[model samples]
Target: MPQNKAAIATQDAPAAIGPYSQAVRSGDLLFTSGQVGFDPASGALVSGGVEAEARQVLKNLAAVVGAAGLQMTDVVKTTVFLADMNDFAAVNAIYAEAFAGAEVMPARSTVQVARLPRDARVEIEAVARFA
Candidate 1:
């Protein structure tokens, strides 16, 4: 049987710069593309350090998830890519605060990558489930 899939998009998040959807919904799950620290209105990475960029990344992810008719609390997993491992603590702090009130924090994996799109300090992607 063929699966039904739909692309999710929102003006609140920066548009994809390449040939990829912002997020794709397959059945009950929504898989979002990795979101860099680009500001939707400006189409540029947010100015500042890792912490600031991480904040914007989360906001972008939130916008994608929200467009799929889900909330941040619905996220079940996440993968974070960072340009530097040294920024882990700062990004972790921001990540924790971003999902503070959730009933259960999503499982996450964070790793240092050699580089990221637009030289962003951070990028984040999420998987959310809907009942």
Candidate 2:
């Protein structure tokens, strides 16, 4: 951790499974690490399907963003990663619903990846500005 940036953590979100912080705040921006569908309490990926996973992923991101004293509406950009491109529609719907309250929807990029940690259906990361 450098003096310019501080790592963010929250019990409301699942702990990082690797050598990374849940998020890091530097200057006016907060950058959240990618979050999957795992529940913080159970430490297990939520059941259902891509939609369920997408919802959980947003919840996890909200927790991380909130930990830094920001809200979903503050998010400026987001990157969504999916294990399968076929799940895009389902995840997109969930993603839209999660940030529906935002005055200006965050810019976004979604991509399909070969695999994800814990085999999650979807993962998301965000950049938010609180200052």
Candidate 3:
């Protein structure tokens, strides 16, 4: 977290609340920890519904990827965790907005979980390529 070659961190993103770095670089891939809707400034989950939360989640991911000197377009894959399957369409729409500039959209998976940290409606993690 101190600007090492392996661990990636940035003040633009919320600090990890657990024992993990925001993202870790392994060779040409950077594996990111799941990000929630918590605001980096207040460290509190954003208000509004799943749509808002999903947007914040993607924003957080962008921050992590940016810290790795990459952009959302560089994300090769993502695993989305949702508290409700019904929110898929909503989250997906927001997700698409973030990667609109990508020549090819990142591969993604969305699954409904029993619960999420901070009781967030949605959470997302990503893998980014250096190239």
Q: What are the per-residue Cα lDDT tens digits for candidate 3 across 3-81?
A: 5359999988899998999999988999999999999999999999998898898899999999999999999999999
Stretches of model 1 off by over 4 angstroms after superposition: none
lDDT, residue 117, candidate 2: 96
Query: Each model's TM-score, in the order given?
Result: 0.97, 0.96, 0.95
Task: List pairs with backbone clashes in candidate 3.
Answer: none
lDDT of 1 by residue, 1-131 (tens): 88699999999999999999999999899999999999999998898889889999999999999998899999999999999999999999999988997999999998899999989989999999997
Which order, best to worst by lDDT?
1, 2, 3
Instruction: Rate residue 45 of model 3 by lDDT.
Output: 96
Off by over 4 Å in 3: 1-5
Off by over 4 Å in 2: none
Clashes of 1: 0
The positional error of residue 105 in candidate 3, measured at the CA in angstroms, is: 0.9
Task: Give the root-mean-square deviation of each candidate in angstroms.
Answer: 0.8, 1.5, 2.9
Q: Clashing residue pairs in candidate 1, if any?
A: none
Q: Write the per-residue lDDT of candidate 2 for residues 49-93, one digit (tens) a residue.
A: 888888899999999999999999999999999999998888888
Per-residue lDDT of 113 in model 3: 99
